[model samples]
Target: MGLGFGFKGRIVACAMSSLLATIAAPVWAAADIVIGQVAPLTGVIAGTGDEYVAGAHAYFAHVNAKGGVNGRKIRVVVKDDGYKPDQTLALTKEMIAQDNPVALFGFVGTANVLSLVKNKVLSDAGIALLAPYTGSLDLREPMNPNIFHIRASYTDETAKMVEHLHTIGIRKFAVMYQDDAFGKSGLAGAESALAKLGLKAVATGSYDRTKPEEVGAAIKAIEPASPEAIIMVSVNKASSAFIKQLRAAGSRAQLYSISVVNFKELLKNAGEEIVRGVGIAQVMPFPYTPATPVVREFQGLMQQYAPGKVISYASMESFVAAKVLVEALRRAGPEPTREKVLAALEAVRDYDVGGFKIGFGPNNRIGSRFVDITVIGRDGKLLK
Candidate 1:
């Protein structure tokens, strides 16, 4: 809750990732550029943060290996917030007040980011928050110059899901979401999407994000309506539990989720039997695909830097975010200031990073509109 040891304890080296004390060895130099992350490293969402940090560090390691990013090595200083918004606010301020990172990158959760924005912390400091890892529409609506998002909005995702399901003639939708900003964001998106199609959700359910294991009641709450499709806007633990319990309760509605739900964690929490045929929208392209240059490059980097770990959307999204951060820093020229970096980000437009394109102009922080759907195959892995 306070300045715990995990603050700045997470070390992402050029060669690899480490959690051990850096003082024990001669590693990072004065020339290395540091980025800060306030993430969940000690809660149910820990694996999500881990995968994201791994991806960002792995990409940075690749960049460092190739003569660094504009002759400066990249390092990430991470703090564990246990997915608590208050902890995120405190540690984020500490990260800025103490570490003096060039940028604040990859903070997870809608509420955490909302806390920062509500207090005007990042904007007040002139620090840019690149890709805070949530698809909340509130972040995108008012056009905060300090925030830049690389993924599709929650509206883009849920609308895509609803549109696809509607095209396939499956209406009668229900929603199960966390009782929080993140969940309500998806709920609003679904509502808008359904409204656009002249349809409405049959039933909806809510569960506490912190008490994710209490998903049985939420599942039972939606059973009576018997929707043909259940749109889920929650994280891995509760979403998987809902799916498991819904199936156990004999509700045969096909389950769908937004991109924020980590499919790997879902698979780990709910086995293949319960998760089969469940659809989830993805903002990032399939990481396993060889055709997409960015994904292929990400795969190669994961092989070299994170060999034993599995490739996931969280990591892949972080890798892309790292690439974007590096490019913007590069554009800021040598000896870049945070203000210069902000200016550089504002100028980005239709810039291609490998296969995908990310663009941001003045008054527009939404980078990409790409969204796709994937389903869990019978074998437990998500299929495109």
Candidate 2:
């Protein structure tokens, strides 16, 4: 009887040990914080998407290598939406179903963000949406509680362009924009800024992205009006085409473009000689400027992660977005919940990360509103 009781006690001890192992396994496993991103990875706007993703990944890799955020590893899942609204919605839904990420980061286009906003997924999920590439007024105006924008709005860029144009004695202006929400938002901002100066656009032209070849005709139509400057509210590809057509047509008007026109791509498309003397409004400081601490750190990271590539405002914005998210996560403390993260972000005030200062409150979702004008010199450099 004593031998049988000892055998049963040993069996009960083994069962208890097995139960404890099962109970503690999950607790011992590494906690993961997933971040979802949707961008135009393989379509017309793929170049922009590439820059954004590169910057974001570089930041994430740097953070992960340094023990991650409060011991929780960050996993970034990027999906290609081809810069289309319907496709973006599908991709976003897939992210929610598969990853259920803590937040959405680096979504590329205005139309894509608009689609998500229309669907109300950000609010429903109570997930933080950060640093969407576009600066559409819709993102700022409606004040979506969960969505936070780190870049300057198109309105801010337009106002700065108009102010600089006025300084340069450019009263007569013609506008060329893509016939979409992003372009329309730019046009509206330009109109509003012009109104402030008691001026108006003398000639206006619009083109659909589907037919970029028609952009030359749009420029031709605007040129006949003989405005002193042409303000282009199109993306990089269309802007390049317009520049080529304008130069070929000998339209000698000064050209000013929104920040969407990638200066590097423009130089490639319409050679340095052709794109010389073009003016652009930049929301962030020049990425190559190693004078600022933030710029130096960004340059270092880019060298480490994405070597030999020119950094642009878009890339810097991506970096700043990552910095802001990391800072919010740090402030959220150990074992962070979604509510803690949101509260931490709301508590952020005058938070300076490198050169950019970000401030978000209960009433303010737009973080930065600063803008500067930079001109492309004859040597293919953006001169401030």
Candidate 3:
């Protein structure tokens, strides 16, 4: 069974209420800051959501241990939305109404995030929506002021992969993507990127995320296209299955993937031999690099909080999101309000956290768009 927060909330509430009564003090002062998070703690995408939540919690724990932001402790109220759009909308509404958190952070999926964005709740309420895990084009284009993205868009990752492929003289391309909004967006972006080089995908295939059997069939159909390379825009599990099937079919075309498929799970499931020579695009610095201070700190935190887990691009993105939120909270100061916090976040320009610098302006909501491409080596590691 999935863990629910209601029981924990009641216990915390009772203890806080009792402490306040005993001390004759208010439970929350005007300066108290609370951030809300809605993620799929249970369901198909739970693993992704759990990584984000864990990173956010670990960052706040560090901040709180160091006396917090301007003497105010940060409280994150997380709810499970199961990666469902309807549940995300409902739970987000509840967070705003009941918890009255200053902002929303770490929402899980593209459809779910887009659903909340469509309702205009974040803009209307002047709340910050930070570092949503999805790389959908909708989040970056025609941007909303309230949503600050720390991760690169799928468009950015796809474009980078296409550029790298072109550099390697692989002209003819094909795409295999999950048939959803994410897939369509990725397809559109890849087409546009290829157009820049006066080229386009020779073939395209898609699979429904609900059906795993269809993925292998789709790959089989696309293999006949005989393109120079195949770009996979999919999650880890589906991507692994597709690669395994493609290898089984004796397809030797170069395999390329967006960051979603560039995960430890993919490497583990598909093995080094299967993933060797595969190219993957990333939006964040490689997790194994210890030269950068931010990377070093993140490594230490991961070791202390989530040891034995191989760090991936998503984990780095989650860490960056936590840093951005902490920066906003610090700028908002002790007597922070929702409006003030949002304004503070908007004011972030060339702000450096350790070594990573992020900037957010009035015209732009996304702080970073830089991406790097890496390939899986024979040792089963992504190397630049």
Using lDDT, give the best candidate's number. Answer: 1
Query: Which residue runs of candidate 2 sit more than 4 Å off their true CA positions?
Result: 1-27, 308-310
Residue runs of model 1 more than 4 Å from their true location after superposition: 1-30
Candidate 2, residues 198-265, lDDT tens digits: the string is 99999999888766547966876797888888888888888888988887877888888888778888
- On the 0 to 100 scale, the lDDT of residue 212 in model 1 is 86
lDDT of all predictions, in order shown? 0.88, 0.84, 0.82
Q: Report the lDDT tens digits of candidate 3 across residue range 1-384.
A: 656558888899899999889789765564457899999888765667777787667678788778788888888899998877889999998899899898788887788888888998787777888888878988778877888887788898889889888997999999998888777888888999999999989888888866633586678668888889988888777788888988888889998888766456777778888889888888877778887888898888877767765466666777878888888888887777888888988999987767777888999887888788888886776789
* Candidates 1 and 2, the one with greater TM-score: 2
Q: What's the true lDDT of residue 296 in model 3? A: 90
Q: How many clashes would you count in candidate 3?
A: 0
**C-alpha lDDT of residue 125 in model 1:** 88
Question: What's the C-alpha lDDT at position 247 in model 1?
Answer: 85
How many clashing residue pairs, candidate 2?
0
Which 10-residue span in candidate 2 carries the lowest summed lDDT?
Answer: 1-10
